[model samples]
Target: MKILSITTATNHLSVALNDDDQVISEKNEQDQRNHSEHLDPMIQDILTENRLSLQDIDRFAVAIGPGSYTGLRIGITTVKMFASILEKEVVGISTLKSLAKGIDQKDSLIIAMLDARNDNYFAGGYFGQALTNVIPDGHYHIDQLLEEIKKFSQENNIDQVVFVGSGIDKHDELVQKLGLNYTYGSESQNELHAGLIGKLAVNEEAIDPDKLLPRYLRRTQAEVDWHKRTGKPFAPDSDYVEEV
Candidate 1:
């Protein structure tokens, strides 16, 4: 089976093509947010380098995110469009889950965190290779996240955790203040990788292209502002109003 995966859920954009044997091609650009500008060219480069086309892929995988909203839209839309055009299977994998899969720590808690700004983050906690969710994935304040981590660790008697993603740098000092043993994920692991996303999506059930959506955990700024102006509570997960 051949899988082509794209990840633009963070500041980085990564693309990978994998066959039954191994990853054939993988490309990454860090500190770049122009996913709409660069993603197509990057995909073409990866496919051309591998002597394959979009039609050659058996499955399409995308990191449907809790990262950058614009990035997620671009990636998910691109993947869905490809799947729609080719009538191929498409799998949407969580950005946090993919980040956790990049960590190879044995029997340790894996915490995936991506910054959401304003002292908030998109976070998930997985334990060991089983990928158990210790703390649920969602937008969280730093203190709330820390409290949950503490509760889970104390309850499970786990001493340390394996932390990964760009949010690690943003909360390094705060995490350290917890006085719990923890290790920072390697620099290579901090960035999103499409190969890892592809591997995780291998056995996932494919959905219709139209059903795929980016997992934005919080309300967009415009939506939040609208609620403030209208005296309506900002409910992100509820039915969204079409922006005019």
Candidate 2:
């Protein structure tokens, strides 16, 4: 299968093109908040280098986030647009899951966090490759998430959970302050990775191309304003607002 995937659910943005045997091309950027500017050229370069057109792609896999709202939107929206035109299968890989894979936390309870700003984060938990407790991919103060993590850890007797993503840096010192056993990882080891996302996504059954989406944990300021303008308490449990 000629699979292509894009992931920008963290500070780093990465794209990958892979074949049934192995990856054929890949691109990534670490400059913070550069997805908007760099994503297009990066995708173009990858495709040009591989000598493949969008029509050649067999599957479209994307990191459906718990990361930057804008970045997640760009990643999913672009993929959805292309896939819709090409009628390709679409796969949604959770941003937290991709972060977990980056750290190879197959044996440990994994907590993947991406900064959601204002001292809040988009966080979720995985119990040894199985998603045990997910926060509905919502936003919460770090402390609130930490409390839940503590409770979950105690109940499961999880000694040391591996943490990754840009969010952890915000609470690194506090993690030690809380006396939590943890380790820090580099950007390459923490952020959502397209190579892994694409490969993993291909194993799943395809969903409607239009159903492809971003898991933005909280409402964007614009969304809030639109909701306020109309009079609706934004759906708390949902992550996406269908594009009009």
Best by TM-score: 1
lDDT per residue as tens, model 1, 143-193 = 988888888988988888888886666677888887788998898998899
RMSD of each: 3.2, 3.5
Q: How would you encode candidate 2's per-residue C-alpha lDDT over 172-234 as one tens digit per residue?
A: 777776566777667577756788787677676788977777776666779878887999777
Q: Kindly provide the TM-score of model 1 when superposed on the true structure, using C-alpha atoms.
A: 0.90
> How does candidate 1 score on lDDT?
0.84
Give the clash count for each candidate.
0, 0
Write down the lDDT of every candidate, Cα atoms only: 0.84, 0.76
Question: Which parts of model 1 are misplaced by more than 4 Å?
Answer: 169-173, 229-244
TM-score of each: 0.90, 0.84
Q: Which candidate tops lDDT?
A: 1
